[model samples]
Every structure is written in C-alpha cells, then in structure tokens.
Target: MTATTQPLHGRVDPAALPRHVSLADTVGQTMTMAWRATLKMRRNFEQFFDVTIQPLLFTAMFAGIFGGAISGSVDNYLPLLIPGLIGQTVLTACVATGTQLREDMDKGVFDRFKVLPISRIAPLAGPMVADMIRYFIAATLTFATGIAMGYRPGGGVVGVAAAILLAIVAGWSLAWIFTWFGTVGSSAQAVQGISLMVMFPLTFLSNAFVPTDTMPGWLQAFADINPVSHIISAIRDLANDGAVTAEVGWALLGCLAVIAIFAPLSVRGFTKKM
Candidate 1:
C-alpha cells in the first residue's frame, strides 16, 4: 500500500501520495491491523465482557422477566427470546466498534496509523475483522444460555449454527455505520451516546420480544420495516423452523446495503479526519 498522508487542512491529497497500492500489500496490512486490534482486545479483556457476560445476563433476565408475561412460560419464550437476544446482543456488540474507534482516535492511535504506509481502510476494517470474534462469542453464548434455560431449537445444531453465522455477518456490516460515527463524532462518549440512540429504537421497536400483532398499528408499521425485525425473523426461521426463509435473504441484503453505503463513507470520513 502506498504511504499516504492527510493534507494539513483537508482531505488526503492524492497528488502527494503514490498512485497505487498493490492488492496483496493491502490485504496483508489489513490483517496486520486486525492483529493490532486483537492485541488491544487482549490488553483490555473487558472488551470481551459485553459479548461474554451480556448474553448470559440478558438471556436470563429477559427470559425471567418476560417469559411468563410474553409467552406464558420461560421454556415457551425461548423459541422467541433466544433468537431475539441473538440479534440484540450482536447489535449491542457492534456499537462498541464505533465507540472504541473514537476512543482510539482521541488517543492518537489512528494518527500513527495515518503516517504508516498502510491502507486507509486497514485501520478501520481490521478492527472490524477482529470484532467478528466478539460477534461470534455473543451469538454462541446467547444460544448456550438459552439451551441451559431449557430452550431447545427445533432447527437443531445446523440451523443454530447458521443463525450464529448470520448474526456475525450482520454485526460486522452494522459496525461500519458506527465506524462512520467514530470518524465524525467529537468524542468517544458522544459517539457512544448517539450509537445507542439509534440502536435502542431499532432493537425495541422490532419483533425482538413480541410479535408485531400485539403492537399498535403505527408501531407495527415501523416494526415491519425494521432491519432488526428481518434479522430476528431470519434467525427464527433458521433456528426454530430450520428453514432458509425469505427473511434471511432480506436481512443479508440489508447487511450488504449497509456495507456498500457505510464502508466508503467510513473510509472517506477517516481519510478526511486524517
């Protein structure tokens, strides 16, 4: 990858940088950044806590609190609650990506990245790559916790596995939005607060805990269009019914759409910030 610098007052000046970066070097550098992210995760093991602990807590908490209220019993709710929690946990986990990126930028870590002959996206994409591990942990533990709570997925192991993979892909794609937030926000707390504002609505407004039929008409309309609703429905089809339903396709398309739009925006924003 060409060594590039952001011009002192504006966007990166391509005129000042080498014209090209080989694809191979780009891949290598991206992985190196992934490695760096992994190391940071190691130093701050608390990064894993959200993925590790939240699953257990949310699974138990939600099931205990809403099980009887929502489904008449905890075991009965697992079919709905487990899949919903997967989406919730994964969505919540990706929010940290943006928050941490903002924190890193505030600390000048990204400034060092800018000076190196590394790909601009490597610094952003690499951390996301490592974060896939976090997404996986969150999804898996949600399932494990549900199983411990007497929730048996009718789709069995293969179906549950597919749901987990989908959650990871969705989480990774969604993280790019937060990546953009990280690049533009004034501070880590600010970015974190904004990301949560977006996250909570999508999560709660969706069919995560209850069917849309129980919601008001206006709320139902929003839930019908909520990306999290599609994702949870897809997870339900895969994990509960063992069916690769249309919701899966829709959820994946949403992920691709988020990436296509946000990926470039994040890269450009990062470039400009540099």
Candidate 2:
C-alpha cells in the first residue's frame, strides 16, 4: 500500500494520541465535565430543595432537642450546636453524590462516557466537583440559621468563613470515599444503604450531638478518636474561642489524610470498569 493509505511505520504521531492519557489533560477534561454538571444543577434549580430544606429542618430540630438537653437554652446552645450541625449536614450531603453516580451507571451514562476520548477520571471528578455545590448550600444555611438563633463566633467573620471553608473541603474529600462505593456497588439503593450505615454511626456517635466525655468508657474511647469529633471540635474552637488552635490543625490534617488515601484509589476505580 502507498504511504498515503499506509499506517505509520513504527512510531505513532504524538498529535493523534488521546488527551486523557496525560495528567494535565485529564484534569482539564475532568474540570470541564464537572463544569457541565454544575451548570445542569443551576438550570434545574428546584433540585436544590434538599440542600435548603434539610439544613433548615436539622438546625431547628437538633437545636431544640440536643441543644436543650445539653446546653439548656437556645441562647447558650446556638454557638456549640451550629458548628456541629454544619459538619453533620455537609457530611450527610455527600451520600447523594455517590447515589447519583450509581444512577448514572444504571442509565448507561458512564458506559457512554467510557467510550469517549475524554479522560476516564472526568466522570468521577465531575460528580465530586458538582457535589460541592450541595455542601456549600448546606454549610451556608447551617451557619445562617445559627446566626439567626443568636449564635455568633468569637473568631469573628473570618472564623465563620473558615468554618464554611472547612465544611467544603471536608465534604469534597469525603466524596472520594463514596465515589469508591459508587464504583463498586451494584445499585444506587445499595450505595445509599451502605453509606448510610457507615455515616450514621460515625456522625451520630461522635461529638456532633453530645460531648465525648459524657459517653461510656469504650464508646468514649471511640468518640475521642473519631475524625468527626475533631472536625466538630475545630469548628467549635474557631467559632467560640476565636483562636486557630491545635484542633483545627488536626482536623485539617485528618481531612488531607483522607484525600491522600482515597483520591488515587478513586481514580483507579473510575478508570477501570468493574
């Protein structure tokens, strides 16, 4: 055959290579996919009901129940409970993201994506990025509700801002864990069921609802070491004490640790079909 119709001798043209193979290209592709999903969320704005409603109901209920039980008055409990609510709400929103991923798989969206020239990581990264909006809404409403209930942080506006930032980062990082589940789980319901089983124990048993010191010996031991406790403590310290203390440092360190361990695993799971 003539060179015009012949395949290249031994070397393939670099320009012909798929962009997804490179790290920068993959990240850009992922971000673009994520951006598309974000725009979709904006267009279907009514879907934000959970983000808006859950925080409102939770802040009201938990503030009344746990707040009254622990701190005795809304006046005194708002500061402590609001930060805890922020952590709990953000963590809970993460589950929906994984469940959505399972839905996408069921509808063959992921199968279509896998056949495209786009980076394999794009599907997973896109959902993770899109899910941040949910976290942001939850955190914002939780903080706002706290303020309305007479909660003010000693760390001033900056502390309030940091608390929100922490919620976003923590929520984003934890999404990796659920992404792994979505990659492996058989169905959306299974993903939700598994995630809830784990999250309920983690969030409820920690300092989110009560102090660690009030627990039984074995339970207190678990609560002390729980990452959720650290996050809640950091938020409380920043909001109530106005100091960037060791708890914040440790909490951030824990979040980074989670990201480091799970991000690569998530990428691998996304790239290879189950």
Q: Report the lDDT of model 2 for residue 21.
A: 69
lDDT of 2 by residue, 132-228 (tens): 8888888889888878877777888888778778888888988788888887788999999998997888898898877788899999999889898
Indicate the residue-level lDDT of 98 in model 1.
97
Off by over 4 Å in 2: 1-20
Using Cα atoms with residue i matched to residue i, what is each candidate's TM-score against the true structure?
Answer: 0.93, 0.89
* Candidate closest to the true structure, highest lDDT: 1
RMSD of each: 4.0, 4.1
Model 2 RMSD vs true structure: 4.1
Model 1 C-alpha RMSD to native: 4.0
Q: Looking at model 2, report the run of 10 residues with the lowest lDDT sum.
A: 6-15
State the number of backbone clashes in model 1: 0
TM-score of 2: 0.89
lDDT of 1 by residue, 5-63 (tens): 65575655445665467899889988999999999899999999999999999999999
**What's the C-alpha lDDT at position 153 in model 1?**
94
Predictions in order: lDDT: 0.92, 0.80
